[model samples]
Target: MKTIGQPPFYSSFFLATVIIALFLGISSFVTYQQTPWKAPASADAKKNPLASDAATIAAGKEVYVKECQSCHGKKGKGDGPSAATLDIPAGNFSTAATQGQSDGALFWKIEEGRKPMPSFKKKLTENQAWQTVVFIRTLK
Candidate 1:
């Protein structure tokens, strides 16, 4: 039996409630993903100690393959094997949004990662992380 005052299956009020809930859910997801990934101003000022030469980039590539390729993709398009499973999509190095950030900012981010992306400080030496930045440049 139906309730005396409950919403019917297709009532406008019921539909509106469902739509609002859906919109809120989608908005929250977007907000979580679009949250800024910024480093401190001090980090932004820091320069890359390593050169952008072949050897530097090559060394970076090796590390990236082991540590990052699963998420950042083979060419740094953020389309790697595990990307689909992540709540936060991997960053694409080819885009201007990534390239626009300073090298120091990149290093800082690698050193102190936000949720989803792990902080490489413990896993990689400072030089290694810097080299990874150099390699990332080539992806653009």
Candidate 2:
């Protein structure tokens, strides 16, 4: 049934739903385009002072479990319990995109985090940060 001057209620609802879906799709694409989590050239040039020895990896594992596991997952897969709520996704250490990054770049990202990730510069020491990087390398 249709009124002369009014569109059907379902048509209006459908149109609104379509608009919302389009808006959300566009916004997600825009966000992805803007979030280029790349470390600077200088950061890439920096080095990891700690070796990936057993002791260092052990220490890194401890820190990661305490600080990063909530968002990065126990296995560094970026599918932690809280990952679903984030505006930007966490880095998945198992991926080649992550494994290919230099140690310094990973260190920089951990030290100076992006919007959803907090900076660890003050929370963790340089040694600990490097140790975490070592642990990350083992994720692959």
Candidate 3:
């Protein structure tokens, strides 16, 4: 027979497990929400070889359409279909915060993506990544 005052052993264990899981889940969410996705100072210093060139910008548009449009939207508004499903919101490139960043900083971000954003360091050639930064600059 079980005692009236005390909970069963399995029930207590299950409650404890649930509490711990909840704590971890909340902690992770808070941490992820608080962290900023900033490139290193070294990365910020790295310049784009093809900065603002018309042809490079055009090439970058093609790459953005093929690779980034799904997550960043057709106009870089961060309102893509998949944006609804992400834990972190997709960046709005048209915003001043994004536009204000240096080309190198933007390039570094594209090369080394954060969670929910795939890194293009391996997937895209250096030229292509730099070109993408050029295309992003045109988003208004």
- Per lDDT, the best of the predicted structures is 1
Residue 46 CA displacement from its true place in model 3, Å: 0.5
lDDT of 3 by residue, 37-133 (tens): 7778888788889858888889999999999988899899998878888888898999988998888899998988888899999999999998998
Candidate 2's residue-wise lDDT over 1-140, tens digit each? Answer: 55798887899999999999999999989977665678888888897888888999999999999999999999999999999998777978999999999998999999998878999999999988998999999999
Clashes of each: 0, 0, 0
Tens-digit lDDT track for model 1 on 5-84? Answer: 86776798878999999999999988776777878889988989999998998999999999999999999998999999
Record all residue pairs in model 3 with backbone atoms less than 3 Å apart, i.e. clashing.
Answer: none
Better candidate by TM-score, 1 or 3:
3
Q: How far does residue 25 in candidate 3 sit from its true spot (Å)?
A: 4.6
How far off is residue 53 in model 3, in Å?
2.9
The regions of model 1 sitting more than 4 angstroms off are 1-31
Score candidate 1 by lDDT: 0.92
State every prediction's TM-score relative to the real structure: 0.78, 0.77, 0.81
Q: List the residue pairs that clash in candidate 2.
A: none
Query: What is the model-wide C-alpha lDDT for candidate 3?
Result: 0.89
